[model samples]
Target: MTVPPDDPAIRAQGLVRSFGPVQAVRGVSLEVRRGEIFGLVGPDGAGKTTIMRMLAGVLRPDAGEIDLGGIDVVAEPERARAELSYMPQRFGLYEDLTVGENIFFYGELFRVPHAQRRARSGQLLEAAGLAPFRRRLAGQLSGGMKQKLGLVCALIHTPRVLLLDEPTTGVDPVSRREFWAILYDLRDSGVTILLSTAYMDEAERCSRLALLHAGLVRTCDTPSGLKRAMAGALVAVVAGDPRAVHAALAGAPGVLGRLLMGDRVHVRVDDSDRRVPELRALLAGRGIADAAFTAIEPGIEDVFVALLGPEEAA
Candidate 1:
């Protein structure tokens, strides 16, 4: 159950993809270790899907080398694809096919033997909690159920590496949690998973994360390491007018940064230990009272805002 030392599961160096005049991915290099979950996180049109497609051997990169499980993906796509499974944002599931039928179809396409396909389909159906609904048409399933069915199809042949593009989007909270549970089980069983996600919480679950912004890798590290690299301390400010507080504190002395999170304003300071008193007085001077403030640790979202800064350019 060991991946060869020479095989990285997925390795790309200087990867670049462009659409005519627009460059989607620029000089992106990534390596996913065996039996680990790696996350690529960013906003819409951030080139995450482009990279995933290239690794899956669906879309060719304009420049760079892609290797999958010791096979050159660009040179030998067929061989590379044989060892990988890709679940795109919109999975290809036959609406008229039953849950069991769809799984069997994918297994057959992957060239799984008849005996193995039967056993594998049963195990996958049970694992996805779709065994009881095996006879139901895929179109009749709920959004979450459909997503689970898609995952089961992708994993029917037990691929060495799994590439998922926003697999949990539009899923309910409970189902998202369950989906992650299943993913953890797969990782524990020696699958290398590289997934793209918009949810900050989901990104935090990965062993390591790469932040992609404007077609570049802004930073890549473990979640804890990224947070620790943040230079300022985070302070949450609860005010009657959070917007006003945000504006008032934008360039105020001692303020390094600020983020608007729902109803609270997260302010970053040059020094968390000393900024509280000054912040309070500054608000008081502006006739803003009853402001509740607390020093809190920075999360992934906070780090993103700090790095990206305010949306409007200076």
Candidate 2:
């Protein structure tokens, strides 16, 4: 399960793609190290799926260079695709097929040997906790279980790279955690995973992640790195009138971003020590003298809004 030195599992440079006058991806570039879980995080319509499809060789980019496992994904897709397994948002599993049959079908399609398929299917089922449901039909399974079967089918051939697009959306929190555990296990076994997710919490679990928005990468780094890169301090203001507090501070100097959470309003500013006095004065002017304030740690959502402003993250 050891990874090769100095060789990235996947690399894309200056990728650009457009569809019917709408630009989906705009000069996006990224690299995924061997045996690391790299996350592409963004809200919907952020071009995460488009970039993934290009890397998976399912779609051609209008312009870019892509390489996977040392093979040029754009120039030699067939050879590059041999070392990858991609499970998109909606996997095409036959409703009538049992879990065992579904795995068998995928194994056959991949040209896996009968003995190897049998062994692999058994191992995957046991590892995924699906050994008891081998006889159950695919459509009858829960959303999380269906996702597990898809992963099993994808892993049956033992590819070097795994590409997943928004894998945990709509899944229950418990299932999402379980799926992430499985991903970590695969990473420990030397499988490089590149998955896209809209959830900021899930993005924090990756070894490194790129934040994409409006077809561009706003930032790319480890969760801590991204948090540290935020150019401000977060102040939580507990007030009886959060809406008024937010409105009052919305256009204040040095204010980066603001969020209203129940009775509290979190504001990001360039310098809380320098501005809290002025902020207090402003609140007092507005007849808001009872508000309590405390500096707080910045979350991913805060960083995004601080970097892109509230209009963009929304």
Candidate 3:
């Protein structure tokens, strides 16, 4: 079911949270539509986790309003929590218990009836690829399998909203793909998912994304929309000495900035058509005559790097 345009499944206005002297989440506002995959993308220490915790009712917000399905999360946490499921970065699971046992425990805790738990657990195990491993101890499972089990436990009651904080951090590429496939299936089945991710490719899969930096949202929009909003043209320059190339083009006219991507440097310029030849000439003048340059379309990663600035320096 599509979300009502006026009614968001999850809504936050002026959300703020602090940890001792650190303002972890600062005046953040967001709205998540029903059945939509909304991604919170940022690096570590960007307060993504803090925001998720507050929304999940695990931590109280210092200030602001949190509404989940029209229930005020901050004012009525238990009621709000009844409609939400949270899978933290390090979701706790009883490692010694069998997969079936783990699911049963979580379902019971959520107050699912015995008969309903039996039926729901079976479906969740199959969906998470844990049906065959039902008899296996959770501790004996692989890293990916363990994560899948955690997800099944978190979803046993079939919550309307799913909050995942960096769920696929260290999983293999294949497992990550499978996990996302399951998430998309859940979304299609009318479950609103709010996930935080460090992976840019994963963020691209979301219907919408919020880019956070230094406890503030830098931008929020569809992935394509954000890419289209990049302020400068991206030109890829291949040079023998990328450092030297960057140094030479650092202060060149029309050049906004440059980033080194392995063997090549991505130069952001105000006018690519006017700057390419000038950049090539500048590199040649620096005795790096073999440098080749070509203007290319800016991507989400390019925009992210540009907005967040250089990681080492920033």
Candidate 4:
């Protein structure tokens, strides 16, 4: 079931939260339509976790409103939480309990009736490739397997919305891919997922994203929409001396900014059509003429740097 245009599955308006002197989230507002994978993409200390906590009803917002499937989450946290699942970076799993026991424990916590719990647990474990390890203790599982089990436990109640905080961080590449595949399946089954992630590539997999920085939102849009909103042309330059190239292009006319990526530099200019030749001339003038120049599609990292004026794109 697609989200109705008029009623979003998750809505936060003018949300604010603080820790003593530091304001973690400052009046952030966002909406997640049902069945969409909405991403909270940001670097460390970007208030992603704070916002997620508020949405999960674990932290009370000092001000503003939070609604989950039309329930007032900020006021009636328990009621709202019943319709959502929250899987944090480090999920609380009983190390000594078998996978099946852990699933049943969470099922009991959510008050899922025994019969439904058995069926749902079986289905989730199978979908997560953990059916064979039903008797394995949680601590004996691989990091990926533990995470998968955590997801299964969180999903025991089959809530309408799922909130995940940096779910793929520190996971192996293959495990990360597998976890994302599971997410796709959930979204296809009409579960609205709101997840926070620092990885740019992971952010790309979302239907839409809110780019956060230092307790403020830099921008929010679809990956392509964010890139398209970037106000200039991008060019990639590979040079023998990338430092020298950066120094030459720093503050150059028609150049907006430049970022170093390995031995190459991504330069954004007001108009590459008119400025690339000049850039080439400048590189040659600096006693480096063999630099390769190519126009490339703007990646999210490039768009982030352009929008935020910083290079924290990881």
Per-residue C-alpha lDDT of model 4 across residues 249-311, encoded as one tens digit per residue: 888899997998889999999998999999999889988887888999888888888888755
Between candidates 2 and 3, the one scoring higher on lDDT is 2
> Model 1, residue 199: displacement in angstroms?
0.7
Judged by whole-model lDDT over C-alpha atoms, candidate 4 comes out at 0.90
Candidate 3 vs candidate 4: the TM-score winner is 4
Candidate 1 Cα deviation (angstroms), residue 73: 0.5
TM-score of each: 0.96, 0.93, 0.94, 0.95
Worst 10 residues of 1 by lDDT: 305-314
After superposing all C-alphas onto the true structure, candidate 4 shows an RMSD in angstroms of: 2.0
- List the candidate 3 regions with Cα displacement exceeding 4 Å: 1-6, 312-314
* lDDT-better candidate, 3 vs 4: 4
What TM-score quantifies how close candidate 4 is to the native fold?
A: 0.95
Give the whole-model CA lDDT for all candidates, comma-separated.
0.87, 0.89, 0.88, 0.90
Candidate topping TM-score: 1
lDDT digits (tens) for residues 87-179 of candidate 2: 998866887999999999989888889999999899889888899999999999998898988999999999989999988888899988888
Number of residue pairs clashing in candidate 3, backbone atoms closer than 3 angstroms, sequence gap of 3 or more or interchain: 0
Q: Lowest-scoring 10 consecutive residues by lDDT in candidate 3?
A: 305-314
The clash count of every prediction, one per candidate, is 0, 0, 0, 0
Cα lDDT for residue 211, candidate 3: 92
Which one is best on lDDT?
4
Q: Candidate 2 at residue 312, lDDT?
A: 78
Candidate 1 local lDDT, 1-314, one digit each (tens): 35576567788999999999999998899988888899998887888999989999999989999977668899888987668999999857999999888987888899998898889778877888888999999999988899999989998898989999999999999888888988999999999999998888898999999988877778889999999998889999998889888888978888878988878999989887788988899899998887899989888888877788757211
Model 1's TM-score against the true structure: 0.96
